[model samples]
Target chain A: MKEQDDKQIIIHVDNLVKKFGDFEANKDLCFDVYKGEIFGFLGANGAGKTTAIKILSGLSSPTSGIVEVAGFDVYKNADDIKRNIGYMSQKFSLYEDLTVKENIRFYGGIYGMRAKLIKERTHELLSRLEMTDYADKLIAEIPLGWKQKLAFSVAVLHRPKIVFLDEPTGGVDPITRRQFWDLIYEAVEDGITVFVTTHYMDEAEYCHRVSIMVDGRIAALDTPDGLKQQYGAGSMNDVFLKLARA
Target chain B: MNRFFAFVKKEFLHIFRDYRTMIILFGMPIAQLLIFGFVISNEIRDAHIAILDHSKDEHTQKITEKLVSSGYFILSDELKNENEIDACFRAGNAKLALVFEPGFGRLLEKTGKANLQIIADASDPNSAEMLSNYTQAIISAYIKDLNMAGYGNKIIRAETRMQFNPGLKGVFMFVPGTMALILMLISAMMTSITIAREKETGTMEVLLISPLRPIQIILGKVAPYLLLSFINAIVILALGFFVFGLPIRGSLILLLAESMLFILMALSLGILISTVAKSQQVAMFISMFALLLPTMLLSGFIFPIENMPVILQYLSAIMPPRWFIVIIKNIMLKGTGFLFVWKETLILTLMAIAFVVVSVKKFKLRLE
Candidate 1:
């Protein structure tokens, strides 16, 4: 329950390679994510962060590598991995027709949450997001920022060991983005591992540890300050541009 | 199983929550049935006809009166001359015209013969053909009646009445078939498209990553549509029975059980389609192409499969509609017991099982 007490290795990947025919979307990728920490997995588009995250989330298979998340083998224990991990894609996957409560209840049902518990938790989730009044409102009526936050909350509603947020802050307002990070901070405080990918350099500075991918490979992996100092850059964006150019 | 139920619940929410899909799945069936059943019957209804009786004799009067009272034709006008027949028809005054030669009543007494000409406008061939056929029947009946009166020994009688549909109304045939086709397309095609839509939009990935098993997810997604389609089937059947006077002379229990079986088969097809397509558009195109046209053309619902080409007949044998239509005809028209329909039921059950099995396998492969 204490801060940094759940600092266990939540994700462990070694030499992970995801190849489609002759093209390798993720080649020889390696990383480790610690519990109770927001780990930034940054890369330009097509730099294999998505493929690696998919493999880690048990959504896809690695070509020939050892990938483990929460001690469940990516290939052998996929269902176990799916059970232990939650994913919120960049697309904000939520049923548009169903009400906010219905969406939560349906996803909760997927997580095998008991009806009474889903009810209690759904109520708590709405109140926590200040979305209690809108529980009856269909998701289509909600703003994109609130929907994004709701999607993230619902993703981790069952309290998975690790949560994967694939560009969860795309196109959101600056104030809402800040609020979204606060929600992520709260999740991290509860000892949940947060694996997030984003183009926002300011958000990367908030991560405990960060890895920048370049050209289907992990180009650099270190703390924010160390990355900035090593790359001799003013910010993570400069570090990225420098690394991407070199 | 639990996960599938949840996904099915989600599916139901998606289906019921969207008014468009509800209208398509449910509204279309009842609308199609009513349109096909009540509106589009080939039976003549208060059809107007002009009579060109040049002689104005007692026999022509009696026959024309009989024709008007037959309920199939209404005498719109009594023309004075043959020239008026074509002009009245050209003016669209009547679909048919009856012209009797001079002295029709006197000819029966003298030579026991008379010339009665039934002239119908050929512009619309369907009504013309039907008019000619009915006119021929009325003339034959009159001759037979005259013979019976003259000879007093009624050798042969023709007191013909159409069985099931006493008026031989075409709506009686269309209602059941329309319901079957609409339900099949909506339940199977729309559900499949919705399922495939989730996959395309990356929402399926979100569900797959959850604690829910793949089967649970699919079952959950399809469950609501199944229930909705069932409700649709009931509404249409009720409308057909109550509104259109279409009878279900067979066991109601058997008909319901058969309908449920058909719903399952159609839902399985939706599942199969979802597995094949990755987007709503592709799923829709496939469902429209695969189910709708085939259900209409090859099902023996409108066009008899027996009259189709040998290759088409063989193709129809594999169509679920063909079996469904047979079952409906047996129940609605023949009023037969379940024993007679067991073979078609077995085929539908097998098709349902095959689709469910194939969809399950395809779904599993996607997970793998």
Candidate 2:
């Protein structure tokens, strides 16, 4: 593993807490995500994984924390944080009625991109995704896996410093999930940090660093193999089971 | 500004691509206007009546001839005596019964007074009232003619003239009412549903995380609807003028300006509703019950406000469309200027400001 001092830190969270009335959704969370790395946030259903991602993406305010995203404070510089981040929700977020190119143009326009740049990027993205023929087809006509791939591409279109994905591969087939991870690897290669949350244990093995959240708290966080060896488990599934059961 | 325009363009595309939305936006106004104009009417025509000529004198015969020739009464049944009047009414053959007293012409000459009774079916009170009024007018006109022909010297008369609507056409009333209803539905309901649709589909999450401000999102969502609703207002006005012959007696510019104000008010109201509603279905339900029903019932659109109960009248005073309808009636029917409707205009302006303020305050800057 690379030494932490040499790598650049993209996100810094210290004692983050989120509460909904009397219920604590996130409690005294602290972690650091390095630049150009796939940092996985893993948890079972209602383990507050989505809530943490939301707070980090500038979609929700942390109750109290020294959270910084892309070197900007989450409290004072939310709009700045927003400008440097791209987010893909767990639900499908593209307009289904719009053609793929139109959807691309809309997102580009809202992000304040120039028209000529949006046009050129549209061509490059379609060709890169091998979706040149389907560019003119409505998103509703495309298959789910293709739609998911297209959504991820759109999220990183502006080359945001960090891209937050909330269970992006949910309900996708295994082959497509593998292909989707390849796309994530390509994004990482472009020097964009990937912050992804997922409940899939096997996918956890792919992350450079993984954080396991249970009952609104991070139970254990480390490299997948380190976590497995530390738990004396054979696989990430067994590691997760031991942590959750404990 | 460019980003705002792009957002607005996308909204327009959504409206145009959805066939159901297109139909509701354009088709509803014309259909509602035609239905209100042609189907639901107050003016009586070709009403059946039974005439009981007890005297059989020349005067009674002449009066009966005049009543039949007036074109309102169709003379469906000719009754022989008083007993047949009940049978004629119960059989549903006639809506009115006209009776002349014995020696009608001789009694008129000797005592200078004669009694004629007009009996109308009161089950349907509105038409019955209309039928009675028509009969009274015809009889009065006949009396005036008789006095001119040296039949009577002195007779008191009450001359009534209907102002604004000389003929009392129902279309005149419905045009303004329908305009208010259509504008409220299109502006408020459409905007709310569109915004709530973003929330339901999860696109709002991405938008909230983006650099776009909340105000920009709201303005972009409502801009397309505002323009489209204005066009709808013009279409309703044009249809009223060309097809129904409803007059625009006041300044056309003033009328359109008032319409724009009402549209703005409704759009803000829609934004307010969307702030509370988490889904399109809930937004639609709130708009239908809260906006559409109140605009129809309490705005003095179909029912007269004076006739409603005191509490309901108080309730109507707070409704936005009530002021709008009054302003429209003043401008279109009464030929009044801005001076006449400034109070209502001020009320609508205040309402628009209040809704915008409340919605802005309630609109969450971050997802909770």
Candidate 3:
């Protein structure tokens, strides 16, 4: 990546702390995501990755922190932040009962898009995903890989400045994951910042920069090669194992 | 307006797409109405009775004939002595037994009084009570006829006028009650289950993150049910009027306005229930137990609340359908104007507002 001065910080989180009663889920978390970068958030189960992401997505409030997403404060300007960002949850975000085109139009319409723009984007997105033939079919009848791709496309349909994907490729085959990464890269190429959380070690390697959270704190943050070099590991998986073991 | 319409359209689609739910939503009201109208009745018809006539006289025979011809009692058997009364009831051959004193006719002629006893099978208390009432009415009418024909003298006579429902048709008693039940079931049960279904399927999370306000989400979920329940109320009222001859004594506009108020109250109750339930099954269970049972039992639907124990009568006051049933019966049967029902309307309005406020509070808490 270029030097930090060349890129603008899109998501700025500083000293983020989230507590549920007395249990601190996120402790003194700090990170900055630059514009047009694929920032990977990596962690094991119960490592506070989701808690921090939820705060950034304006889904939850932090106990004590300064978080800014899409140039809006997390506390007072959540609605403005929500208007500028997109979210695709882990649980198959689109309605399975609705047809593909209907799902796209619904999400777009809820975002306050005009009818003409939604219709035009519906046509463009279906053709670009090469899913034109399956446009009228219910999401339940579509293949898993195709649904995943469509879900990503729908998430970005409103042209939000940044899109947050929480474990977007869990349980997919490796070839589909690769194709899914191709979609992510395509989204990144359009100058859309992609913030994603994943368990896949190899997927972590594909991020421009990755943050590894261990026990509610960022244990390591660096590029893939830099992380591997610092840990004297041969691959991202070995580097993750080293940090997770520590 | 467009987004709200789109959301409501999606809700309607969900309702129509599932044939099973559609059938339940539309079928249950009619089924309950038919069951209450025809299968279950409080009026007595052709009850069996046995006669124990100790006096072999014309006066006793005349009383027996009058009771038999009234179409309320069938003379199933004859009892020679008092001992056979137990056998009649034990064998289930008679629901009541009429006994005459040994010298019935001679005593009435000479002393102006004769003993006539009625023995009713009290095991099924309802039918037993009805049978006894029918017997008393028939005897009183016979006495009045005798006096009128100048054969006897009477001191006083009490005439009863059954005003609204002179015939006491069971349909008149149940129409308002059934309207309350149907509206409560459709508005409260269906809305809670629908909202809970959205939560269970994870679509609620998607909607929450969207630009639509939380109140809009709730209103969108409840609007279709409100319309549907209103339609059901109209269908029930139409059937009650055209098919069952049930009358609406008051202004039709006031009845409809009151009905809409009750529907809003029920819809808000549904929203409150949905906020408490995390899953569809839980929502259904809550509506069934918390809403449906109380509505049917405590609403004075099948039973009169005045006759209930003091605690239950107080409990009935808290049930929304109880007040609704009162308002409907007065307006539809008595033809009372809004001036008579304003108190009930006001109570329902306060309840609706309270439910909506609590639901909004709960929803905001959930977001936090």
Q: What is the TM-score of chain B in candidate 3?
A: 0.94
Candidate 3 or 2, higher DockQ? 2
Question: What TM-score does chain A reach in every model?
Answer: 0.96, 0.98, 0.98
Alpha-carbon runs more than 4 Å astray in model 2: B365-368
Per-residue lDDT for B149-179 in model 1, tens only? 7744332445566777877788777877887
**What TM-score does model 3 achieve against the real structure?**
0.94
Cα lDDT, all candidates: 0.84, 0.92, 0.88
TM-scores of the models, in the given order? Answer: 0.92, 0.97, 0.94
State what share of the real interface contacts each candidate retains: 0.80, 0.82, 0.33
Poorest lDDT segment (10 consecutive residues) of candidate 2 chain A:
A1-10
Q: Pick the candidate with the highest lDDT.
A: 2
For candidate 1, the per-residue lDDT at A214 reads 88
TM-score of chain B only, all predictions? 0.92, 0.95, 0.94
Q: Candidate 3 — which pairs collide?
A: B249-B335, B250-B335
Q: What pairs collide in candidate 2?
A: none
**Native contacts retained by candidate 1:** 0.80
Model with the higher TM-score, candidate 1 or 3: 3
Q: Locate the minimum summed-lDDT window of 10 residues in model 1 chain B.
A: B151-160
* TM-score (C-alpha) between model 2 and the true structure: 0.97
Q: Write the per-residue lDDT of candidate 2 for residues A170-203, one digit (tens) a residue.
A: 9999999999999999999999999999999989
What fraction of the native interface does candidate 3 get right in terms of contacts?
Answer: 0.33
Clashing residue pairs found in predicted model 1: B3-B216, B4-B216, B4-B220, B7-B220, B7-B221, B8-B220, B8-B221
